[model samples]
Target chain A: MRRLRLVIPAALALAAALALPAGAPAPAEARVGGRPPPFVLPAAAGGPTSAPFRMGDHLGQRPVAILFWATWCQPCQQELPFYESLYQRYREQGLRVVAISMDSQATIMRAGPNARRLNVTFDVVTDVDTRVTTQLNPRRAAPFSIWVDRAGRIVREQEGFSPAEQNAVAQGIAELVGR
Target chain B: MDLRRERRGAPRRRLAAPALLALVVLGASAARAQSDLSFELPGVGRTTFSLTSTTTLRYRGENYDANRFDDDFGSLYQRFDVALQADELRAEARIDLFVPHTVLVESRCVGRPLGVDDPSCYLDWDLRPERLTLRWEPSEWVVEAGDTQLVLGRGVALAFRKVDLLAVDNALRGGHVRYQGSNFRFGAHGGLANPQNIDPIDLRIVREPQDVVVGGNMAVVAPAPLGVTLGVHALRVGFEDVDSIDGVTRSRFTDRAVDVAGWSAEAAGLADGQLALYFEANGLRRTQRLVDQARSETGRGVYASAQLQLTELTILVEWKDYTNFLVAPETTEANARRIYSAAPPVEYDGPQRLRGIGNQRGGAIRMDYAFLPGPWSFSVNSALYAFNEEPHRDPFEGVLVSHSWMTLAKRQEYGGDLNWSLDLQGGARFETLLHDHDARFRSGDIDRWMIHGRLDITVGSGDHAFDFIVDHRHEREIRGDVAEFQIGGASVTYTFGIPFTLTLSLRWTDYQPGVVVSRGRREYNFLGGEFYPSLEVRWTFEPGTYLSLFAGQTPGGQLCSGGVCRDVPTFEGFQLTFVGRL
Candidate 1:
């Protein structure tokens, strides 16, 4: 009986809260066919040693692939070598890859070592504060990928990694690079 | 009979009205296709608002054999998160609601004086605004007020943040400011520790202590030629002493204070990014104020690591030492909270509850070599730990432990028609207790071995995939009981394209140290020849949204994430989980 009294009021409050944002205009996010938000973060490994990474500098210069990963995520660990292979294959054809680590302060110290151990040679940066992640991968999914064309527009996005998606991801990159 | 009639009649009517109203409101909102809202404010800037919600509905049809609670009960847990960003300003808030609140049967009510029917065991209903924060960042400066996450100097001094995997989110409710430059960085923060009191999964409410904290850090980087950086940090915390008397909470301010001061130095990008080095050391002072006297104790810690990366080989070595050093230890079981500071544990990321951190020394080394051709790699690691012999103060004193593991992995694709991968790993752990505490006590040495393997095979260009996993552990503990145990599990997952996945898993265990046998009493028993089986189905509605259903039983144990560990309760029920953005 006491539980029922509490549920009724709580349910009504939730309904009211849910309806408050219904009338507002639709907003844009970092998704396919849109321009991704810019970011700057500390470089944990690779690319211009001891320097911070700014996304604007490489936006329109060449085709780019952005990979979001973490040290504790097993899937991320499995998927990194694949991205490393992709970077190695397309580096000479005006392709650039940036791997952003979403490891917090507790585990951020291992990001560099993990990236090194995985044989990743691309630019790796750390989002210790998660400010960039909030704007890009709001759901905090690991092994997320975003492909951008030379014109700085996002062409494709994937939430999780599977061995089956390797060819598709490679094909997307090949198209951007005009292979 | 009259009381029962009133309870069933009035509450049912009240519940139905709001439920109907909610459905109507939700239906009206669902007509829109967008999940986020955006608009421009005059004289201000472009503003955007987004909401994310996760709801879980659970029904327990069967209870554990020794549990006192009856089955056939339902519960709901929901979280609503809202964020707004306008140019350089941002605001965020979150609200959590639970109906007919539930507590962890194993942890909270198994052998305690409270029962499920007791109000002290579970709240009838709960709703709380868990987080609220505002921030402004312009150019090279950031100012945040309300709730904040802060860390200093490799987290040995002070660090507090949200660790979702462990269901631990503790923030500081005050203010913070920082400035970043090309070669210099500075920051400072001060606030009262605001640990989340509600367990999202169990919907249990716990009391939190109000600890006051203040900290700061500064760093300067040398030019390109030097490639070196130096920094310093300091932190102080006043942990309030809290006690419960006759169901009421009380606190004393003049109890204890902890202070840590530290410095760090790092050399990175040396030898053209091939070599990197880091070192940090801290000194701690803890002062206790008694009714008649005040006493103080001193401790210190050091952590260092070195890394070498080359085209085909990578090596990393780490070392850490501490003596009587722990920040804001859980003084009592009732007020269990995450420690304010977390140092790196130089062991494998599993089962850290038994690894002592207050007084210990350890080092680990790992090497990875890509010696084979075409998408194959091998790696090996070894670690050793030793603890001081403090017979009067420590329980697991003079203990020595060692761990070693090796893994081989491969990933291959054949003509874009098929893809496959394999990962095989095996490890062994040994522990020796030097001193004998007593024959009746369960204090002894341990020998354990484990092996894990995973295989993933995908066919037909991202259309279908299958995953198989197997894990086995064998252990022998030489204690008064002299127990020998084994645990094994296997699972298979089938994914149908990009929308759905099905997984079937089974686990068997013969290791039993904490299983209860009698209802309403703490009777010891062994769980021999027990099996737990479960099935799950997941569907993806869109990017950043999903629905999942799970049924059957789960065998829970120690789960570690982000350097924190917690015990999860076993479940025998059906669950539906939904995550959506709007």
Candidate 2:
């Protein structure tokens, strides 16, 4: 075990010498292939509603997009509006969008008003209970977005969203749904 | 007042008989019987009233003249708090009474306790029934609509959940409802809190109260090995004229308010071998509106901690990161005081690294070991904190320090603390300020030496216990300001046949100067010592009733925990506490 530990560091050092510069640009998002875990959560802003909320439910029916957001988070405020516009543009075709809120029940009591004031029109659910989060410890952290194809498999997972990232999400959804 | 004193003293004698007889049978029985309670109320069918109150007085003072006139002078500060709750009237299915007063007394700006002939005093109080309320809890679900506390978690997110038993000062005051089940627990509370009341200045009137809503913690604890804690907190707090100082009436633009929302998830696993591992994460978002500037700022902060224990060793690590999008070009000052209450303002902007240095990165690593063979069980701990400019999310707060030792005190044991190094700091700036000519911290930049000592102390049953220590330290940073400090202290405690025990302690610090401070530097005898004699008397009048009186004096110094430390004020006074359960 000791020899292996020493060997690994030496191998890594050699690899670093051949690798790109330390300041190299971050890698572009690539096509991811894997089955997503299933989940069922309370719907957003409506009566206790549950659409086959699990990941497996949309496997063969439609292309699925899931976005994790919180009420007080500033980044989500800027990102969710963009998702809503894309959902509007593509919902009729075959794309299905699900917005998951990480806010606790206490926060939702106040954020519910803000969402209405902002005119958010989409399907939202609360992850406040940690039913789905503790299981999938996403690397990029919260405010993450994932796109799945009709075959019940994941295609992309973005840690944070910029205009470009959102556009990419829209294009991916369009391709999967339009197919 | 005299009759009330007589009534109180009368119970002391009434409770002493069964207590002494039970003590002869077993000491544990004496304490346990007094703590049992039915947790029932006398109302509804019956008619009765009860009044409960708790008072605490704490005073501390410190003095240090190592170098004179350099912000290192001795000081004194104290706080005396008194709180009372009364259940005044009860009839039918309800009881009505009001808590109308709270008093706090303080004495600030004392250079030293020993030199002062008299201490300055200040008082603050409030007597308002509007700040009070009434409630009824007839079952496992208690719904209280008044000033109360809701404490939960391991003190990470919702640290102070339960109302202070002594202070009775509730943090989240509003309507509180709690539900307790055999396998589950739930609580939800919402109300208005004056964050400014955290440190009330008026002492007479509550000010700057804001809107608050928090759900009590819900947790499930299995028989063993597996448990989880979950909680959600939210608040919309607005300061009353926090931004506008002119005291003018204006639009909502002049209102400074912040909406804060947070959630946390914690899980733990415990197995055999006395080992456990737990992880928790908390996230908070705060949005503030500066009415005068007509601008709103928003920020987010997150923290995560993981702790693990195996056999006799334990390790813990935590990370925190916060950023402000409202402040265009963010600096330390804006983030320190404005963004977070615990963080001190910074002078520059850098990556919130893991370690101590700014615009740099830092983190801390600790390892602990324990022994369990003889009458002694000791643990050795070492921690390292690193700083670099990495823009890391979580930053380390201070320098790296370590200690290795073994000791047996009280606990009916005998052992000795081996050689241990309290600190080994090596940053250029830190080395210069802390080691070179730093008389504020006693003697610095002196010779480094080993600390060898043994402390064997016993209580409750034993003739007498004695503890003593001697240490030597050397300095490398202060080559020109070479010096040495030899410190030694001893303590002896004696227990009497009755319910009274007395303890005596003495400490001395001797300095040997190697460098000159002035042109014609004359060696001065810097003798600092403390004589502490404490007497504790435990008097039990009857079941669930007792009075405790303890009086003593302790030396003042910079008390350090983990790798950080704050000066501990010198203390010389007596404290009497009474605890009753009925």
Q: What share of the true interface contacts does each candidate keep?
A: 0.11, 0.00
Q: How far is candidate 2 from the true structure (C-alpha RMSD, Å)?
A: 26.0
Q: Judging by TM-score against the true structure, name the best candidate.
A: 1
Error of 2 at B422 (Å): 19
DockQ of each: 0.20, 0.01
Expressed as tens digits, the lDDT of each residue in A63-117 for candidate 2 is: 8877777654434544565676677788887777777776542233223323332
Candidate 1 C-alpha lDDT tens digits along B210-231: 7898888899988886778899
lDDT tens per residue, model 2, B1-582: 122122224355344334322322231222223221212344433222211112222222222323222111111111111112112211111111111111111123224321112212112122222224344444345556665433333222332221111111224457777665434567776676522122111122223323344444555534333444455555444444332111222324434455445556544343431222333333333333444355554554344444454434445444434343111112222211121122111111111111222222222333333332212223232222322222233223212222223322112211122211111111111221122233443322322223334333222213222222222222232233434443345654443321223445555433322111221132221222323334555443321223455555444433321111223333444444333211
lDDT of 1 by residue, A1-179 (tens): 34454554465456435533334322112333444544567788433234767776777678888889987665676577777787788899888888898887545656775676566778889876565665455556788877777866555555776554455556666777883
* Model 2: CA > 4 A from native: A1-179, B1-140, B161-170, B180-185, B192-263, B270-275, B289-291, B294-375, B385-456, B459-490, B506-582
Q: What range of 10 consecutive residues in model 2 chain B has the weakest lDDT sum?
A: B344-353
CAPRI tier for the interface of model 2? incorrect
True contacts kept of 1: 0.11
